[model samples]
Structure formats: structure tokens, C-alpha cells
Target: MQRFLPLIIVLVLVGVFLRMMTLEGRNPNEIKSVLIGKPVPEFTLPGLLEEEADLTNAYFNREEPVLVNFFASWCVPCRAEHENLMKLAQEHGVTIVGVAYKDRHADALEFLDELGNPFSRTALDRNGRLAIDFGVTGVPETFVVDADGIITYRHWGPVVGDGLEKAILPALEEAR
Candidate 1:
């Protein structure tokens, strides 16, 4: 057994190396979300537009499907997805809600002012607790929720390039 131990270790290392090589060519954002097909986590947070106003999960209870986007002012990729979000909100008549994850209120407001606010209701998730409930691995994640408040699709990274037109738009149309 002692003589074979070296062989066993070499084989284990080879297996690990091969597995990593498989992921090397894959995009990290292609990681599937665990929250897909589950009901959205419930929470009540302060509205981003007004400190006193409430932004709750109840906002998703509507006739139309809502896109709940989790972003941070500090995230550069979040800026990349802004125009696509605006198109969905204004041109497509979709309800886009933002959860300001782990960002200062002033910074978030400044981000909106500079980038153009597309969200109908932006929820302030100051402590990132709400993001945890949604199983967020990082900022700039977006979830598509049906009118029944069930999460149908979760895009793991900033929706840009073909992401918005391919993944997000199709999922939203199906949800609607």
C-alpha cells in the first residue's frame, strides 16, 4: 500500500488538472443559479428614490413580469448593462426594479443620475442581506420573476452584448 501511495497521488493530481482545464474555456457567468424556478425571497427595503418610501417583494405582484436587478455603484459591469435595462423599461414596457447591493445611498443616487435611472422602483439593500436570500454570488445579477412572484430565470452577470437580447428578453417573454 505504501509503494502505491505515490501512484494514487499522481493520478489524483492529474484528475484535478483535467477538471480545471474544462472550466478554463467556460465563462464564469454561465454558472447556473440555484434560485431559478423557486419563489422569490421576500423582503421589505427602503426605496432608492425616496428614503421614507418602501420597496417590498409585493412590488413584484403585478400583471406583468418584473426584472429584479441586483447591482452596486462600485461595479463597472453594472454600467455596461444600463442601456439594455433602459430599453427594457422604456421601450418594452417592462418593470425593472433594482436592488442596490452593498452601496452607499449617495453613491447609488449619483450612479442613477449619471447613467440614467431605468428602474421603476429601486430597493436599497444596504447590508447585502437581501442579496444573500436571492443566492447572489456577485453584483450585477438579474432575476426574472413571473407575475406570481416566482423566479423563472437568473442571469449571473451583467446583461450585456447578446445577453440581454438572447437570455433576458426570451426568459421575460416566456414569463409574461
Candidate 2:
């Protein structure tokens, strides 16, 4: 019985993991962020565009909520969510700050040129330092920061499908 104890534990652990994965309405990509309900981390980043100014935490301390999106030109899911981000900025008047995660300035510029720039201010996270501070798991994660600069919500993965209408928009409203 003692020799079989390890095997039983492993099997039980595997079963629990599988059950969690199969849970109804559980989004595999949605990794709960530790920064939610906390103040955003302080950091400064260079502008992705030549004429744009540097982006900092101070920009998020405004009267309205802001969306900070982490994306990379090489990420396919980032491309998929670009249109929805544009709609949020243009049609809904949402303020979005973009962070180009571990991407070259030129490539990021080309990406924005091809797919219209929706961000009010774009920052370059060439070393992924900012992403780490924000507890970002990957490119295409977005955080909704409230007026007082507290992160109210985090959406992991591309904001596609009904994500904007159902998740992102409601988060922004609640933050307001």
C-alpha cells in the first residue's frame, strides 16, 4: 500500500486537473491577473511612433478609465483583435494605450500602418519589462484601469467575439 501511495496521488492530481479543464464556461485563456483591484505598476516606455511622446503610468491617472493592451506585431491573435480595438476607440470613445511587447519599432509601425492605429498613445515594450509588471501572460492581454489608476479587470487573450460587448465594455463602465 505504501508503494502505491505515490501512484494514487499522481492519478488523483491528474484527474483534478482534467476536471478543471473540462469545467463548463471555463475559458482556458483567461488567467486571472494578480494586479486586479490594485494600482498599476509604475514604468515608462518609449513611444512606438517617432513623433509620439513617452508613455508612463501618469497617463492612466485620468478622470476616465483607460485600457492598456499588450500586443506584438508577430502575434496572430493580436491581428484578430485589432478591428475590435479600433471600434472601441473610434465608435465608443474608449481610451486605449498600446504596448508593443518585445517587438521592433519598425515592425510595430508597419503593423499599425497596415491595421489602423487605435491607441491614443503607443509604447514599445522591447524587453517585455512592462508586460511582466502588469502580470501579462502573453501578447494580446488587456487591463482596464479605473480613473484613480486601479486595475479593475484583466482580459487575457485577444478581445474578439463578444468579448468587447460582454466583458471589456462592461468592465470599462464599471471602472467609470
Candidate 3:
């Protein structure tokens, strides 16, 4: 029994060490940056326009830069960032595209109508595959893609006040 006691202790210690190591290296908010200096992921989603516009083809191929915002009608932070996006879209000539993350089409349309449709094109990501491809762990994430479809900047959480001009715009300008 005495000899076996040390073996059990060693096994338990090994298990604890492995668990601790896993936790130490784990980052809950970690998102991979795939769009940085790379072509935007190809996605052709249905738009909110009357003509059912294609977002990836129409916007990515354009000569001007574009902003892509991932949001959901159920996300509260998205509401907080709505005004800032609206102002940015109106003031700057930056093209703004919205992806409704894992939401019903009707709810997304209603949310836009109530909050003000600031997006040039709004796409419904009902299955959340696009959001996952973009490495989005939460809503209200924004990405700035240059004219060449290269992702220039990414912002997580609610963007407010000078965040648009201060952080996002500078990156867009640099990419330009």
C-alpha cells in the first residue's frame, strides 16, 4: 500500500499540472486575425436591399474602402454602437456593411428600421458561419477593409465617440 500511495500521488499531481497548464494558456477572448493584409473572405450573402444585393461582390470589388460591422438585434452593445456607426457612415464617405449575426431576417430588419439604417448593405448571417470565419466571438465587432479587399483594422466591443476617427480611420488611411 505504501508503494502504491506514491504512484497515486504522482498521477494526481500530473493531472493537476495538465489542467493548470491548459487554463494558463487559454484565452476566452482570443480571435484570430485572418483579414489583416489579406483578401477578405469570400461570402455572397443576401442583402437587405429591395433587389437582394450581393455584398461581397458589389462592395469588395469597388474602388473605395468599406467597413463591415457584425451585430445582432439581440445584442445590447450593438445598440450602443449604432449611433456611432450612423454618424461615421454619414460623415465619412466610408462604405458601411452590416452583418446581422445569428438573427432572424425579420428581427434584423426591424432593428434597422428602429435604430436607423446606416449600413449601405445589411446581410443576414442566420447560421453564424460568416461570423465564425471572421473569428468573431461576440457581437458589435467591426472590420475595416481597404479598396483592395485587404482587412486593415478590427475592433471588438462597442465603438463609441472618437473610436471611429481615432483608431479605425487612421488604420483605413494607412491602408489607403
Candidate 4:
């Protein structure tokens, strides 16, 4: 029985090692949102550029797919993907709703001034409450919502490089 105990311990250790190996090389940026297949949370946020206006799901017309992107002035990845966002807004004429999460109004304004804003409507999430409702972990996360107001897909990290062609474009089509 003592000799068999040593063999069993060795087998257990080998199994544990193999299981850990399976986790390696996995993409850490991929986060499947619990909100997928669900309706976007309803909230009213102050406009990023204007104080008199408010942004709410009520304004979302159930006739076109839209991109809801959470970004911050301080997030480097957000800056990197700004151009692609512009392409979506101008080239494809896609509607993009931007959320400036946890950034000062002045800073967000400055960032947009430097990068050229591409948002159809920009909301200011000063306390990040809206981002919390959306289950956002960090800045530069994007969600594709169908015309029915259902969230179809979520993309973590910056959507640039081949991500625009391979993942983002396809998801937008699916949402439509």
C-alpha cells in the first residue's frame, strides 16, 4: 500500500501540471460579457460636450445598429484605436456612441480636440456608474447593439489592426 501511495501522488502532480499548461498562451484580453444577448442597461448620462443635453437609451432608434464604446482620455489603447473608430463613423457611416469613463470634462475635450472626435453622441461617465452597469473592466471596451437594442457582441482591449476587419466588422454585420 505504501509503494502504491507514491505512484498515486506522482500521477496527481502530473495531472495538475498538464491542466496548468492548457491555460498558457490563452488571450487575457478576451472577456465574454454577461450582458451578451441581453438588452443594454438603461441610464441617462450628461453629454460629454454639452451640459444641457442628456444621453439615454430612449434616444436609440430601433432602426440601426450602433457601437457603444467605453473610453478614457488617459487610456493609451483608446488613443491607438481612435482612427479605426473614425473609419467606422465616416467610411461606413456607422453610429458610434462614446462613453468617456472617469475622465475630467476638460481632459476629455482636449483628447477629442487632438484626435478628432468620431462619436455621434458622447456621454460623460464621471463616476463610472454607467460603465459599472455595463460590466466594463477597463477603458476601450466596445459593444455592438442591434436595432432591437439587444447587445450582440463585446470586444475587450483596443479594436485595431486585424481586429477591425476580422472581428469588429463581422460583429457589426451580425448585429445588423
Instruction: Report the number of the highest-lDDT candidate.
Output: 2
> Which lDDT tens digits does candidate 2 get at residues 58-117?
888899999999999999999999999999999999999999999998999999999999
Tell how far residue 143 is off in model 1, in angstroms. Answer: 0.5
Report the C-alpha lDDT of model 3 over 1-41, residue by residue, as the tens digit: 99899999999999988786678645446565766777788
Tens digits of per-residue lDDT for model 1, 1-176: 99999999999999987787687545543666788788888888988886447987777788989999999999999999999999988898888899899999999999999999889888789999999999898989999999988999888888999998888999999998
Q: Pick the candidate with the highest TM-score.
A: 2
lDDT per model, in order? 0.89, 0.94, 0.82, 0.90
TM-score of each: 0.84, 0.88, 0.78, 0.86
Per-residue lDDT for 144 in model 2? Answer: 96
Candidate order by decreasing lDDT = 2, 4, 1, 3
Give lDDT tens digits, candidate 4, residues 1-176: 99799999999999987786678755545666999988889999999986438999876656988999999999999999999999999998989999999999999999999999899999999999999999999989999989988888888989889889998899999988
RMSD of each: 3.0, 2.4, 5.3, 2.9
Question: Where does candidate 1 clash, by residue pair?
Answer: none
Which ranges in model 2 have alpha carbons more than 4 Å from their true place? 1-25
Which portions of model 4 miss their true places by more than 4 Å? 1-29
Query: In terms of TM-score, which candidate is stronger, 2 or 3?
Result: 2
Displacement of residue 152 (Cα, Å) in model 1 is 0.7
